[model samples]
Target: MAHIGPAYGSLAANQAKISAKRDPALDQEVQTWIETIIGEKFPNGSYEDALKDGVILCKLMNKLQPNSIPKYATSGGSFKLRENIALFQTAARAYGLEDAELFQSVDLFEKRNIPQVTQCLFALGRHAQRHHFNGPILGPKMSEANMREFTEEQLNAAKNALPLLNEGMNKGANQSGQNFGLTRHI
Candidate 1:
């Protein structure tokens, strides 16, 4: 059962689902992080409203990496505000944050997906440690590579018999003895 609506309807539904799953605690953490980094308080009560214009984001990026955003329009139209977000995203990517950790400008400017905005902020906070910036950390610390070296004998032994993984499943079960529905007639 479905409606013959336009293709964009599904996108709206997805946005609604994401918007519904927003966690207030995460939002508050993101807000605190941005404000602490930028040294400016959020103008609005909620994090989304405070960052919709993208100004604080630019400030955050700059604080993380000085002059990352050379120019972020503080007073302008929608296009200029959107540009600020784009600049922040580019700078964030350059700072080692993956594309998946960044959010689209439309997500914040148009308010289409607030959860993504928060997620992006959290990722930024988590990724900030990479720059060695002397600031408060957010979320779990990004783990470092723990390389392990093995001897040739150990490698050969592992190839010969993977004792740990070779342990086959001994827990057995069969439904042949039990009848779920009506019995078959011969």
Candidate 2:
């Protein structure tokens, strides 16, 4: 056998083998970590559902990494990548993960800027979405009407109260006065 240097053709073969073994292990770790986060976030949630959320969380996190959070219009309107985190966290907590590890990882004081927390949450949410863990969490939709007129404190209160109120939408919730698009009425 000939000695293959770094530039040699063997490098591709070696790299492939390494990646093959590493990918699965990395995915397992991600799965476990997501499970832990989801478990803490949604203590009453079923194991199966939590597992699904975990996978989606991983996908969302990946999107957040390297600066790629989706810009699709959300309940909060046209928010940037960072603000998307806050929106996601607000929704996540509403879905029953108030003490989610994703929030715990952020340090309010250390991070300083509000964007930091938002970005972190966005990243985490992105990761969650990537693995097909995310789905429609049953809860009252935060309409743009309220989001625009409400103060930050008021919005926070609503986000906080969402988990307590109910899971999923309220069939009778009115949307005539909704400030954003019809879809954003949620």
Candidate 3:
């Protein structure tokens, strides 16, 4: 039998390149959290959509399911849903959703009157039990135990829950692509 050394070397090189292109596990973890929060709270929305919204579901959702995205707060002092919605739309565009109709669904709330949107986010948070996000993006010191209280469980919960959330997002995105011909443009 002929030795296929060059062919095997090329295959190995290709595999290495593919592995290098894979998304960082940590980023995937965060993405998972975003998806989980979106699903339980904003069932109709996407992970890309919820992440861009910036509702911070981890702290907001603590009583719901592991995969719930808490609904946004509705009290007078709570964050404005319209602004967050716009932010989320912007983020979604950045995350491979450029020119997608994903933002169209949120336009109605852009005119203000976002109580429903807020409520939906809060509910998602509640279901997901997200309590705190302490990462480089939000700044490491933001979650300092001295300035604030944080149980190891909460931190670990977020960490462990991430992969599952990402799985959900993958499934959701796959379904969307199957149902609506959506493609990853970015």
Number of the predicted model whose TM-score against the real structure is largest:
1
Q: Give model 1 RMSD, 1 decimal.
A: 6.0
The lDDT leader among the candidates is 1
By summed lDDT, which 10 consecutive residues of candidate 1 come out lowest? Answer: 165-174
TM-score of 1: 0.81
Provide TM-scores for the models: 0.81, 0.21, 0.22
Which regions of candidate 3 fall more than 4 Å away from where they truly are? 1-79, 105-186
**Runs off by more than 4 Å, candidate 1:** 1-12, 162-168, 171-186
Candidate 1 per-residue lDDT over residues 1-186, each given as its tens digit: 124354367787886688688898988888888778778789856678789888888888899899988988998887888888888889998988899888887777766678888888778877887667799898888788999999999999888985643465433544375656768899
Candidate 3 lDDT by residue in tens digits, 58-173: 32232222323334443332236445455444443433333533434342332122332333333333322323333112112122235777899988887776575566656645
TM-score of 3: 0.22
| CA lDDT, candidate 2, residue 77 | 27
Clashes of 2: 26
